[model samples]
Target: MVSSDSQYSYTSSSDTELYSPAADIEHPSYISKILSKTKPDEGKARKSIAETHAEGIENTLTRYESSTHGIGPIESVLDEEKPEQFDVKPDTELNEWDPWHYPVDSETGFRIVQFVDNDRDDPRCWTTRARWNYTILLGLVCFDVAMMSAIITGDMKSPAAHFGVSLEVMCLCVSLMVWGFGLGPLIFAPFSEEFGRNRVYQTTLLVAVCFIIPCGAATNIGMLLAFRFLDGVAFSAPMCLIGGSLSDMWRNEERGSAMAIFSVAPFLGPVMGPIVGSLLSVKCSWRWVYYFMIIFSGCLYGVMFIFLPETHHQTILQRRAKKLRAKGDSSYRAISEIKTRSVKKIAKDTLLRPIILLSELIVFLVTLYMAVIYGLLYMFFFAYPVVYGEGKHWGDIKTSLMFIPLGAGTILGTLAAPFLNKDYVKRAKKYIDRGQIPPAELRLIPMMIGCWFVPIGLFAYAWSSYPHISWAGPAFSGFSCGFGFMMLYNPANNYIVDSYQHYAASGLAAKTFVRSMWGGAVPLFTIQMYHRLGYEWASSLMAFISLACCAIPYLFYIYGARIRERSKYAYSPVQGELKDPEQGIDSSAQDMRSNHQLSERVIDNE
Candidate 1:
């Protein structure tokens, strides 16, 4: 008996697991209670594996039915709902269904292996100290991935001079890698879901570490560029998997604090990149930049391989089922094994759905707003050097220190995360009391408040960037920008996940692709933009753009519900009258359930 916490009760572990963050396996008692009400007879229903397993095993059924590639193991509560799909009959010997058959109760016929109450195998049941240890380690990995994006700027001159290329070409090093970050998720997010987080984490990170060696040793620009892109793609697995990994281990109420700690890594890593890169470039050589990444990332990979356990519920159950079968209990099965998907279906979900979701205004504006913010972060790597290094004659090492305030501001945002989450819970209680899900707009309050900080920082940095002014003026301005960056990032990801139910994965993929592409390109033209427009006006240009973006949160906050009501993919409380005849389920009922899950599941990572 899992106690129902109203704060997050909208999702049965089963409903929530359709998206990766929702995939926490709960006790079978809870699942049976919920599923028996929905499908009393159980056996005759032709529901997808997702609906069939929406009881105890979390993603076992949902991930399989939704676009996550396969389901996992659901216990005995629900039998073979879609026997037609499998073409199995009651008397057909168990071997005929071999790898896919549900474990049979000699009398009742169908059973699925499941974790019992307080089962040690469930990640959610792990000790608090263990979970926190993994959380910090995961955050460190995120920092390393983001750091690589900007570290090259520390001594761009050495690389450009050595290779006989221009500074603009060096900018490609950042851009191409960021581009890889975007594209990598399209492949890796699903891969992590299918293969389990630890395997993907170990494999891709090892590849990323290996590729850095080539980057360090490359004689030609071509070799360096090729390997840099590959490293980006490989390192990107963490950014995609860490969010889901955290979800696997933490319950709803406990996740906010962990996420706040996690959120700082992305911004802090980039901020520190120039600082480390510049120090090493001056004391050692530009090649030391790549060497540092190899050493640092290799160490993290070693730690992860030795310490991290498989967090994906489906993979764990699949392995458990395999072991049981090895002992001649052929009836034991994981949901993913019974459910099959075509390559075309998988591609549509991973590739085309994100693009289609962008057509929805919420997805587009939110994505565009994020892209602008991301581009500005990258732009600063160039803009600061122009203001301090070139304009005021400060050396690279000194100029790199200017990023400290930004890092401090991001840490400040992280400190504020718990309070923000607390505030949301307080506000949401009113709706919960009314038996209604809280509006997704509540998530945007932080974004609206945080939005002003970016423009304010930019305006300060712009006016203070004059050569005669104290460096303090331009340098400390980064604090607000960095603060705003962390503050805006987590809520925006929550809003997207809340707005799109089963489709949240694709929605996030869309945002990452667009954001990464724009962030990657910003450095290429930043110097030229500053020179042509003059530092003050160029900074003002971005500040004003950020100022304009402030409307995004308010606009969505006010009219977001209306927009979601009309959207096909975005979760809406107002459901249509349609019903599925074969499954005997009302579309409206499904939407309402999905709506509740959306309001409750706050995904802290994207």
Candidate 2:
């Protein structure tokens, strides 16, 4: 029989021996007292059994890492007396479960871990960063306002009449600019990814200023149209890069508000352009519009060059790594080094992605619907004048002023977006908790509201333009249409972004292509549509089409997530998850390529 107070000893060889205290062992006096009351040596055997269990755990960790890395075998030095204990359950579970590695701060939800200086005087404080970010957004807004002022000049009827050009020819100038704007992104987006955001912005703005100067000096319609198209190309760089720049600075939670403010500029610019252009054209030639834009663009270029630092995390990290390498540091590899693809390959892939996404069934259908909506909205630019001028006897300035209601509606819609987004997020969380699948259709609530109002506004605008009704009816209609427009546009975009997380830029590019084409084509046909059907029937036809398009959002909202789940291109946990905040891209190159292929397959099936 084993003694109760015996300590266990093991021998590996004749020359080597190790001793350890047994788990159930106690002081000799306590063991003797316990033995007096209980069975002798039972505790000694139990303690030996505990020691054996600890030895089993130590062997497991050695095998686990060996299987994972396949690095031959793990040779860990362990003390004979206190051998390392590995929990087999934890090791087995860890091997089975794939770990998600991404740079995410749980407390702040910020992608990058910002090291803050405790000193109040430090420039890297949160307050300073916030202020700088606001300034950048403001600068972008000012740039948008300046560029849009040219649209009013392009939209003017008097200049086309003076030039003895047809309405179609005049509309072509606007169409060309829209075309240039859309096409410019295909080049600029990839270039920005290669070169930095700041470099692209400053260079493009300078090009814009140069082109605007030529537009101001144009003696013929040919010169004016040519310069305007070039200016449009130059201006497109800022539009593409600014959103990415904003993403670099703000976390996902803060991004919605920033996007709201950024979104307003494009809409407001066009609305305000006509107002400013009407007054400027009346007081001075349309030449002053170009001159004013040149001056504004120049000043903005100066300010942006001075203040806008390179905020792109990948570029910043790459530069830091380069500096460290120059100093002969061995540990300064960029996160992007792991994915060693050539720049040419990246460019080729980026260029093809947007085209591939455009071919997707859902993307194509949504884009077509969105394009028609956008075209119909711009068509009103021409239609409003005819209804107000012929029907109500208003001048160009007064006709342009009528767009104020449209701007007002956009403001109201923007204010409501955050509340709507919050509600949807909560609903999504609830669905997850209940083990029920959340559909993407929950995102279309605002879009449904838009569908109801858009047609009503179109009918109201058309019917009320007759001699019997007051002008207030048409104005109210415009306001209603504007509200509907915002509701439809925002949710559609958000849905696409959320669903195609890896291919968002390409998806947006696809949408932009279709939307821009519509914007270009619609105004050209507005005169013909009105002439053939009269104002009431023309707008009513548009309303009918809009009503048909309304079914799209409803279909997607109900079945979108199901479609996404089936889709190879859609966001997924395995391939689509973002890693490395410094690299700052959500989808990997492999995932993006896979998604593009999946999108093609879905399109082909459809």
Candidate 3:
């Protein structure tokens, strides 16, 4: 268990203890408790080979029944589809799945799961270009998912008019979608871990495509809102789980650049949505906006079905083990073969973890900070229209063009990723050279330098929107806001991923719940709030909130090791020499790696 106290002691951290962070083979992390939930005394005793085999067979069937592929693994059938999807691959990051592993090796009784040094088929073993293809594909799916959520921006007023309802009633469609997005990941994240990433993506998107057509076809605001909410639920998998997929394909050091590319999607989608919504509303009606979603997503789904392979390590290993079994080899089994846990236990843990995490002051603080930023971003769909269109008396298309500055700022901020990553690697190298445990705080360097600009940009945008100020003034300030958000978020996102490597999926799922909840809820009052407070003060109030949050990353960067020290999951239980904080990462280096292999159990013949 992780200590509640922050004043705990640490062991030595030498290069010789490189694998020290692995947990004890006997006691797994609490998140993993759902899979192998034997009594502690019984768990300490290794299982027999036959017991392992029986457990594997049962668990594999469970995965098969629930897996996204529905049929089975597609490695063999994918050969024909491989040529067009060239450079598709995985990466070499430290795997979070059962890192302290024990695989059944029938020939040698019990052993561990590991990749051969030259295993080209391993996604982690792929070339950089190949890995990027996998990453870019996932990012594209995420970008499109966000686009669907926000494409209603310009079409909002039109939908109300069509339904003969108030604007707030029609805005319920967006809010419901966001609320559905908040609810989605709890179901999807667990499914992906149980099955595979590709499976969740396929199933969710297929359901989403089906749900979207109905929204366009809807006759009443109620029907439209229902479809949009379900569409949001079905489409949110990419938003919540893409970070974990990126982790699967990239090491922590390389994650900054990839996360930077991804971070823009959520922000960009709202701005980009107005472009399509504005155009289609003029010529084709608001329904065409939903129609465009259908066409674009349908094509993307087709590409995905043919191209995306299993990326989760557990599922892929099971596939390999199954193939070996057909050839009369039974030495292979994944670490999850230890035992089968009850559905009750699994459900109890899954539903409660996000709450438990939020209970932690630090986790709550960071997650809240992320939610605030996301909420502000979502509210802009309404706020931007108010500021640029009504205030300036501009037409719909002209108002849509104004959003370009925010996108420009986001793109410019992403361009800073290489430097951020370079800085991370340089510092990481120094820690490695010192034989010190590298802290996840190294990723927050950008946040330390750039968080202040968030408030600054908000303040600038607030005061610049009047007729006296040129539109360029607000536009340039939009760029600053974009830059500031990117700077603040890139590090924040990467830090969470790095901090909760094992629970990354669930961690992010909980995050999305909060983020989307706010994203959905805040927009309801955005236009009203702006009217009540006036744009400058309303925007300045948001700026004040952002200014307060600027302290988060800096606080974590300083005391992060102390914070992680109290987390059972965060700090690897290793025994190594501790370095002073001023010197380097002083890790609790307990060799948490457990390799308890199953032995043969004799059975009496009837």
Angstrom error at residue 90, model 2: 22
TM-score per candidate, in order? Answer: 0.83, 0.72, 0.75
> How well is each residue in 101-184 modelled by candidate 2, as lDDT tens digits?
012222222222111112121122236466456545554644463335335533467667777887767776667776677667
Give candidate 2's whole-model lDDT. Answer: 0.58
Query: What are the runs in model 3 whose C-alpha is more than 4 Å off?
Result: 1-114, 126-130, 251-257, 338-342, 431-435, 497-507, 557-606
Task: Give candidate 3's error at residue 431 in angstroms.
Answer: 4.1
Q: How far is candidate 3 from the true structure (C-alpha RMSD, Å)?
A: 14.7
Per-candidate clash tally:
8, 2, 22
Q: Every model's Cα RMSD, please?
A: 8.7, 15.6, 14.7
TM-score ranking, high to low = 1, 3, 2
RMSD of 2: 15.6
- What's model 2's TM-score? 0.72
Residue-level lDDT of model 1, residues 1-606, one tens digit each, is 122232112223554342111134333433334333543444543232324443444434442333231111111212456322332223323332222223243332335555544456778789999999998999899899999989988778899999999998988999999998988877776675467788888999989999999999999999999999999998887877776777677766677777676678878899999999999999999999999998999999999999999877768878878877786656676666655445666677778888998899998999999999899999999999999988999999999999999999999988998898889878866655444556778889999999999999999999999999999999999999999987798788778877876667677778888998999989889999999999999999999999999999999999999999888888776533434445443544544444334323334333
Q: In lDDT terms, which candidate is top? A: 1
The lDDT of each candidate is 0.75, 0.58, 0.63
Regions of model 2 farther than 4 Å from truth = 1-150, 153-155, 337-344, 435-437, 572-606
